[model samples]
Target chain A: MNNYERYMGMVKGEQVDYVPRIPILMHYAAKHIGASYADFAGDYNTLVKANIALAEDFGVSQLDIMSDPWRETADYGAEIEYLETTCPQCLKHPLEDSKDLSLLTRPEVGKTTRLTAAIKAIEAYKAYGYKEYSITGWVEGPAAEASDIRGVSNFMIDLIDDEEFACELMDLCVDVAIEFAKAQIAAGADTIGVGDAIASQMSADMYERLVFPREKRLVDGIHEAGGLVRLHICGNTNHILPVAASLGVDIIDCDWMVDVVKVRELFPKNTVIAGNLDPVEGIMESTPEKIHQNFIDLYHKVGNPYFVNAGCEVPMDTPKENLQALCKPIQYNSSI
Target chain B: MMDLKDLTEAIKTGNRTQATSLTQEALDADLTPQSILDAMVVGMDEIGDKFKRNEVFVPEMLIAARAMNESMAILEPSLVKSGYKPLATAVIGTVQGDLHDIGKNLVSMMWKGSALNVIDLGTNVTPDKFVAAIKEHDAKLVGLSALLTTTMPSMKATVEAIKSEELSDVKILIGGAPVTQSFADQIGADGYSPDAASAVDSAHQLLGIR
Candidate 1:
């Protein structure tokens, strides 16, 4: 089966040729194509080229349009500083003052430069007829987007002191995200990746009360748009896994700090659970043999409906052979 | 007549206004600034323990830290007037190529709550800046932070840059989401803490203090 069919089969709990590999790559992909992160993030053609090249060469199951967390934030009137090699930084958050929420206006996703670039990349992927691989479009999750719009430190304070304001801000972010996800789906993305790394830092109670419902809304919106949702929240999400599992997303990414067995137990049996590996220790520093063994161990614990990926973005400096080991297929034993 | 317990409770609950008022009242009652500061530390220590136990989280820790900071603002003049000196000096920042500062900020606040002098270089700090801060402050400890796998190389480079200076007296402590004890050893970091609360203990250990 092609990568697309393999992914569909695995997600559906049906038989597949092998486990699908869907590691999130950003700076790493830019390096793979020998392009600066700035150019790769700015130009849709370069972004598409880098993703397609990595997908073809490494046998990756999906091509992600994830360059950095600031894409949607930048389009929302925040001042973003783009570095030559590093992910762009949000210099001036639009909602620096929580009261400035009234000043904020959601940009038209199809018209904004950054969002349009991502949509155009998805269009390019479809134009290139890379139907065998799943093409993913990404948007910031409510909490993460709120953090981006109002600096992370400031937003965390908002969650405590101004619950109403925080909820209002998150609502705006979810609305924008829904629109952006729909635009990308219309532009040919099969999956929408929602990144909410900031949500992991909150207590389980806070997440359930403040963040989870917004996330559920975003997931429901994507499903309504005829696209699958891949939720990637980087960091230790063990405390919030129960709530996260309730979002009904197609895939849930567990970071290295979470126990894979616990995650498997918390999540539904058929939901595609991806990763719980330390990107630094499990993939970057380990030998190819060790990396493969790690994957095998994780696969054994979680069983099928699993995707091979690191807990977070693949480090840019990770060895090619290590990643190759990750993408390499393993023979499944029916008895196990 | 001021109740130190009230001050402690204020800090613990992250009631910044109450903490500030209680601190002022304590000072007006002729309470020694050291004793008032100790009360705030007691509150922060409780918050740190709860954080380690997973009973609390970043928001709670941040609020408690804010309350402590507010009390400290009221107590600073008295502490200095009484010829107070920090336990020791430490320099801290997120390494180059990383802009995430929440973790680093927590560590810095914990160090200050523990009565250590902190020279914060903010985020995306280079190795040279770290070395310079250490030299300038005569700091005994250097804390490095990074939140991205992509910036781990920069952490390694920063560590190498500090080591090259042969600052044998300096101890390097690193922490972040992607950082590990093994990675710390691989990069020649003197110490690593899994979380910000433990970072205080790690800093104390590295400095040969309780």
Candidate 2:
């Protein structure tokens, strides 16, 4: 079966020839194409070329239209500082003053430069006719998007002191995410990845009250748009695994700090689980033999309907052999 | 009936207005500025411990810190008038090639609440800048942060640059989502902290303050 067919089959709980590997490669991909991260993030052609080249070279199962988290916030007029080899930084938050919330309105997806660039990247991947590979479009999850728009420290305070305002802001972020996801879907993205790294920093109670409902809406919206969802929250999410599982996204990524055995216990059997590897130790610093062994142990713990990837973005300096080990197909007993 | 204890409670619960009012009332009641400051410390200590126990998370710690900051703004003039001095000077920033700073900012705030003079160099700080700040401030402690594995090398570079400046007397502390004790030792750092609250303890430990 083709890579896309294998990935979709696994997501659908069908038997697959082998597990699919869809590691999130950002700076690594940029370096693969001999381009600076600033160039990769700023130009859609750079991002698409880098991703396509990396996919071809590394045999990764997917190509993602993801460069940085600041894209959505940048479109909202937040000040961002692009770097030579690192992800772009959001220097100024748009909603620093609560009064700015009233003045803020969602930008049209196709009109905004960054968002349109992402959609165009998806279209370019489709034009390349790599039907065997899954093309992913990404959006910030509600809580993360809110944190992006409002500064992280300010948004954290807002959650406690002004729940109503937090919800209002989150709703607006979710609306933007829905529109963005739909636009990418229309641009031929087969799946959408929702990154809510900030949600993992909250307590289970806080996530349930403030973050989960909006995330649920984003997930449901993406599903309705006829695209699968990959929910990635970077950090130990053990406290909110159940709440995350209940969102009904096709895949839930567990960071390195999360217990894989507990993830299997908390998530339903059919749910496709991806990642719990310590990106630094399990990928960047390890030898090929060590990486292969780590994945073997991880797969045993996480069980089937599992995709292979690092807990977070693969570090830019990761050895090519380590990645090769990661992409190496597992030999499984068909009986199981 | 609103005493210093009320001020502590206000800060702990993140009631900014109550914290401000309680601080003002404490001053009006002729309470020592040190005592009021101590009350804020007590509140931060409680939140810090709760954070260590996972009973509280980032938002709770942030709001509580905000409350403490708000109260400190009212109490600072009195403390300065009474000749209060910060414990020590600390220079902190996220290392170069790393833009994530929430953790660094939290540590900076915790140090400030604990009465340490913090010189925040902000994010994407290079090694030369770190050494320059250390030399300029004659800082007793330098805290380096990096949230990305890719940036860990930058942390190492900063640590080496600072150490190479013949500031062996100055302690270096490192922390972030991807940092670890082994990595700290590997990079020849003086200390490592996993989170912001413990970062205060680590800072004190590094300086032989407590």
Best by DockQ: 1
Q: Candidate 2 — which residues are off by over 4 angstroms? A: A332-336
The alpha-carbon deviation from the true structure for residue A118 of candidate 2, after best TM-score superposition, in angstroms, is 1.2
Top of the candidates by TM-score: 1
* Error at A136, model 1, angstroms: 0.6
Model 2 complex DockQ against the native: 0.70
Worst 10 residues of 2 chain A by lDDT: A327-336
> For residues A265-291, could you state the per-residue lDDT of candidate 1 as single tens digits?
888888888996788888988899999
Each candidate structure's count of clashing pairs? 0, 0
True contacts kept of each: 0.60, 0.64
Residues B145-195, model 2: lDDT tens digits: 998777888888898898788998899999998788988998899999998
